[model samples]
Target: MNSIDKELLIKMYMNMVKIRRFEEKANELFLNGEIPGFVHLYIGEEAIATGVMFNLNTDDYITSTHRGHGHTISKGAELKPMMAEIMGKKTGYCHGKGGSMHIADFKVGMLGANGVVGGGFAIATGAALAAKLRGSKQVAVCFFGDGASNRGTFHESLNMASAWRLPVIFVCENNQYASTTPYRTTTSVENIADRAIGYSIPGVVANGNDVFDVYEVAKAAVERAREGGGPTLIEAKTYRIKGHFVGDPEMYRTKEEVNEHFENDDPIKNFKSQVLRRGELTDEEMDDIDKRVADEIKEAVEYGRKSPYPEPEEIYDDLYV
Candidate 1:
């Protein structure tokens, strides 16, 4: 708990709960057809986003993946705009054009959530290079999946980032599957972090289900980057509790495996138990945070519902071509 302050610890708890509940709401809305398009719910990996993002500054940049609502929310994006974006409302972050896979808020240094696997690599690397050139302390974080690690973009980006000594961190959310194929079947390495050896940068691995574990590791990496120590590769071992996308048949895994993670490996529940056991936070405090987050999410969904959809004629707007 070297990096964990009481306030930040509590905030992390609140954020974890917020991400979990928000995804649950998104799932409900998608099932009801209130939200259009495919939604890959980030239900189980709440700790990874909350823990790693807990110490970031407003100037720090973060690139997100398709399962990115959690990252967007953790990076301090407004709930209303995010919900509206997912709902395809005109008031959305991208005027509803980007939808769930492409919500971005540059003011907060969130580059964007990309639908393409490994798409954020170049953007994050570029952001890091810009920061270094401008003599700024901003660090860039690229969040990709285990599947993305196998792509050429990952290798190309890492090679450049390492060579330049850019202030970037590559975070791989290894959920053990690339769509329908198991990660082990595709990736030759046992641990994704091991690949960092080729780049000659620090490679670290942490339990994604444990917020404190992630926080400790991320804090060190962030501090090192700010001190001009260059890039780090972090592989968070997490599990996706849902199908790759909403309405997926999910024949790749068994129900028992999913249920086991839900019951035994739930990060929120584990954090709550740890905090209560250590007297870090009282039950009343935890309940209060939960209530507040619930209310916030409730209002966000209502706002999205009441928000107007983009007019058909507005399609030509915000386009370069």
Candidate 2:
């Protein structure tokens, strides 16, 4: 494999760290009754978002799932507004109206996170269609999970995109289990990428836990889409270390299983080890980044706490009839 630029690798590592830290902080706040609504922590799936987003330009569009904070952050969403949004403050991106599952920053091309399973399929496909119609090189990425592949929207969007040769990339974050059910039981195919065969598109699978692996695959797909090569289906094989939600009892999976993944397959730890071994980045640089991220997260919590809640009269302000 070709060596990635040291600067880019460092940036990717930083983004992954940010995603993990933000999720950890959010989990803490949620447990402490500081954050409102349901929180789906993307603790174990940082590499996929960080790597994929790194390959995308600010003008490139992406539709996200409920577990979307990582996507938003990786796409350049400010931490303060994101934290405020999760806490339901008026200073948030949606003015606190759209909580954890619905955060969006159109300026960064994050086309909102969907609460419904597989909801992003049509939206992303539509964005790609719009780009194609406008005769632009922009591409749209749809980030869904293994569970969403079962939805009709997935098939419909893939078929239409393939037929029209839309500039879109279908990224399936196949974290093994969909909610509480094992994807093995629910999914008909062994790998979600295999589904792309039916749509007559390229199907590729990558190690979602490895940022470098994900970056390479996503880079190729993004490039292909920008060059009008049509959509590509990338299935990222990883695990969900956390429960479905913050307060979930998680009776479906065993603790030993979760612990094993957390300990051995930790993306951040593995990334650091690999880079450090290769002398790509110094330990001091990584330590400084860790310190900076900690400080930023601390400030974000403060910002969210200090921000006022939206007034009752403004409930219908951003709503469309």
Error in Å for residue 93 of model 2: 0.4
TM-score of 2: 0.98
Q: What lDDT does candidate 2 reach at residue 266?
A: 90
- Per-residue lDDT over 1-321 for candidate 1, one digit per residue giving the tens place of the 0 to 100 score: 655778987899999999989999999999999999989988889999988898799889999999999999999999999999999999999999999999999989999999999999999999999999999999999999999999999999999999999999999999888987899998989999999999999999999999999888898899988889999999999999999998989999999999998999899999989988988899999999999999999999999999999999998997885
Q: What is the lDDT of residue 222 in candidate 1?
A: 91
Angstrom error of the Cα, residue 172, model 1: value is 0.5
Show the colliding residue pairs in model 1: none
Please state the error at residue 215 of candidate 2 in Å.
0.5
Clashes of each: 0, 0
Q: What is the lDDT of residue 66 in candidate 2?
A: 97
Residue pairs with backbone atoms closer than 3 Å in model 2 (clashes): none
Measured over all alpha carbons after superposition, the RMSD of each candidate to the real structure, in angstroms, is 1.0, 1.0
